[model samples]
Target: MPRYEYRCRTCGDTFELSRPMAQSSAPAACPDGHEDTVKLLSAVAVGGTASAAPAGSGGGCCGGGCCG
Candidate 1:
């Protein structure tokens, strides 16, 4: 299960919940029992090393920013 961040509009409190993706969009209540809460858009981070391209091998002028 992925954790989701939510904010209560009534009491202005932020909270988190661990639930399934299917219920991610469902309504959530804050710790204070405020039902006027909204789900926040979270940023996902992906990590990995990308292989570099060979030297002098690219789309030419545009790739090298030679187009002014």
Candidate 2:
């Protein structure tokens, strides 16, 4: 199951629900019983330890910036 964030247009309430991926896009109602609710686009984040930097890898321009 995955958690989904939704917002109600009628009552202006926001809520969350846990449902199967198959029903992720299904219609949902707000806690205040507002049926005009829409799912919100949420961000996903992954975390891990930073990798070691090679020696002599000082402040050199990378492709990420214009300095690359």
Candidate 3:
């Protein structure tokens, strides 16, 4: 399941919901029972390690400082 952010125009409140991607475009009501709501744009962050470059290398243009 993915989480989505929403804002209620009636009460000016923001909320979140966990739902399937199919229903991501579906309308959602606010906690205060406000039907005038709109989905908000969300940003995703990815974190990981890069192993493309070997140790003791500058990892430059060719990952081996060859372009220098």
Best by lDDT: 1
Candidate 2 whole-model C-alpha lDDT, 0 to 1: 0.86
Error of 3 at 67 (Å): 22
Per-residue lDDT tens digits for candidate 3, residues 1-68, read 89999999998999999999999999999999989999999988987668444565765576566775
Candidate 2: 10-residue stretch with minimal lDDT? 59-68
**Runs with alpha carbons beyond 4 Å of true place in candidate 2:** 49-68
Candidate 1 lDDT, 1-68, residue by residue in tens: 89999999999989999999999999999999889999999999987548766655656796665677
- List per-prediction Cα lDDT, in the order shown: 0.89, 0.86, 0.89
Candidate 2 structure quality by residue, lDDT tens digits, 1-68:
79999999998888999999999999998998889999999999977548856555655556234373
TM-score of each: 0.71, 0.70, 0.67
| TM-score-sorted candidate list, best first | 1, 2, 3
Best by TM-score: 1
Cα TM-score of candidate 1: 0.71
Number of backbone-clashing residue pairs for each candidate, in the order shown: 0, 0, 0
Superposition TM-score, candidate 2 onto the true structure: 0.70
